[model samples]
Target chain A: DVKVTQSSRYLVKRTGEKVFLECVQDMDHENMFWYRQDPGLGLRLIYFSYDVKMKEKGDIPEGYSVSREKKERFSLILESASTNQTSMYLCASRRAVETQYFGPGTRLLVL
Target chain B: DQQVKQNSPSLSVQEGRISILNCDYTNSMFDYFLWYKKYPAEGPTFLISISSIKDKNEDGRFTVFLNKSAKHLSLHIVPSQPGDSAVYFCAASALMGAQKLVFGQGTRLTINP
Candidate 1:
């Protein structure tokens, strides 16, 4: 089974603080994605990486950025955490055109 | 703009009954559709998927029906169990999108014992 692990299950940060959410996959999948889930809004993609050092902005990438320095790890960076950024963050990893496996998710609370 | 839509925000069903969840898409280019289940504070998990070529796909108690002409699909769960209660998100991807999925707002399902 593919296993995707996130850095934290819950995170808290103050306003204007930088936040980092890490994700690692054991299956060596080349594709990884980050999404923030909100009530009545579903899951919106923040960013995705197709390969090492390759990244692309998704539909809702406004206040988020991502880094993929290695094939097994993907990182999401919050430049300046705001209250609006408080939400459940999920990480998913997949092979080309395959089903995406997701981590447990991290609930971020920016105060 | 909101390519995928799950109109029903919530549904309640009695155990041992059938639960039908519907999804619609505005983009005709979508060739792959998927269903995912998510629990509170957890990431969405892949439930089932269907390709445009097939009208129906079934696994265990879950069946996915696709209607290409209407650009719609539905997920049917038979003998619904309390554990089946979760938020279900419908997602779609165009063949050339490289698996970038557009997801609906999701439907929260509840099963009564």
Candidate 2:
């Protein structure tokens, strides 16, 4: 079975504070993704990394950045968190076009 | 523009009754379709999927039917159980390799006793 783990299950941060969310996968998948889920928006992709040091912006990537320094780990960074950034964050990893395995999401609260 | 759409925001059904969820896509390039089920505060899980070449696929109590000409797909759950209640999302992918799925706003399904 594939396992994807996130650094935190819940987090709280003040406005303008820097935040980092980490994800690690044990399947050695080359593709990793970050997504935010909202009530009416479903799951929108924030950023994705196809390989180490290779990143691509998804539909909504304005306030977020991702790091893939290693194959097993992917990190999402909020340069300066805002209240609007409060939401559930999900991390997924897959091999090429196969089914993606997701980690239990991190619910971030930016106050 | 929303390429993938789930018109119904929510659906309610009695336990042991059949539950049908619908999805539509506007992009012709989409050749792969998938359905995911998400619980509150958890990541979405892969439910069922159908390739464009095939019109239907079934797994236990769950069945997926695809209508290529209409660019639509539907999921049918037989004898719906309370545990089946969750948010269902429809997703599409155009590329076969290195695919990035485009998802629709999910439909929340509830099973009433």
Candidate 3:
């Protein structure tokens, strides 16, 4: 089974604090993505990496960044957390043009 | 502008009845479409997908129909069960877009007993 695992299922952070969410995939997929789900907004991509050490900004990437140091893992960073950044973060990995597999998701609450 | 849109914010259907959810896209470059089901506090799961070349694709009780001319698609669930209650999102991707998927606003589906 293709499995994607996130570092935390839920997180709470104070305003202006730095936050990092990690995701790991066991399927050796070459593409990984980070998305935030908001009410009435569905899932909007924050960032995506097609290869190690390579990253591209998505539709809603202003407040987020991503890193892919290794093939199996991707990380999303919020330089300074704000209440507007509170959301359900999802990580997805796909191989070539195949369907994406998602992690359980991390619900972050920025206070 | 929203490239992908799910007109209905929510839908309610009784058990054993067919549930239909609709999606529309404005980007003509999108040639691939997909449907995902998400439960509260959980990541969206892949439900079904249909390529622009084909009009229909079915998996078990879930069937997806695509209309390329209209830039629209629909998902039909037969004999909807309580477990099928979830938010349904439609996504589209173009060959040039690589792996990035543009998603719809999503429709909340409720299955009543």
DockQ numbers for every candidate?
A: 0.83, 0.81, 0.83
Stretches of candidate 2 exceeding 4 Å from the true structure: none
In order, the Cα lDDT scores of the candidates are 0.93, 0.93, 0.94
Cα RMSD to native, each candidate? 0.8, 0.9, 0.8
Q: Could you tell me the fnat of model 2?
A: 0.73
Give each candidate's interface RMSD in Å: 1.0, 1.0, 0.9
**Model 2, A17-48: lDDT tens per residue?**
99999999999999899999999898899999
Candidate 1 true-interface contact recovery: 0.84
Please, what are the lDDT tens digits per residue for candidate 2 over residues B1-113? 89999999999999999999999999999998889999998988999998888999999999999999999999999989999999999999875655788899999999999
Model 3 alpha-carbon miss at residue B35, Å: 0.6
Clashes of each: 0, 0, 0
- Model 3 TM-score, 2 decimals: 0.98
Candidate 1: tens digits of C-alpha lDDT, residues B11-78: 99999999999999999889988999999988889999999989999999999999998988999999
Measure candidate 3: CA RMSD. 0.8
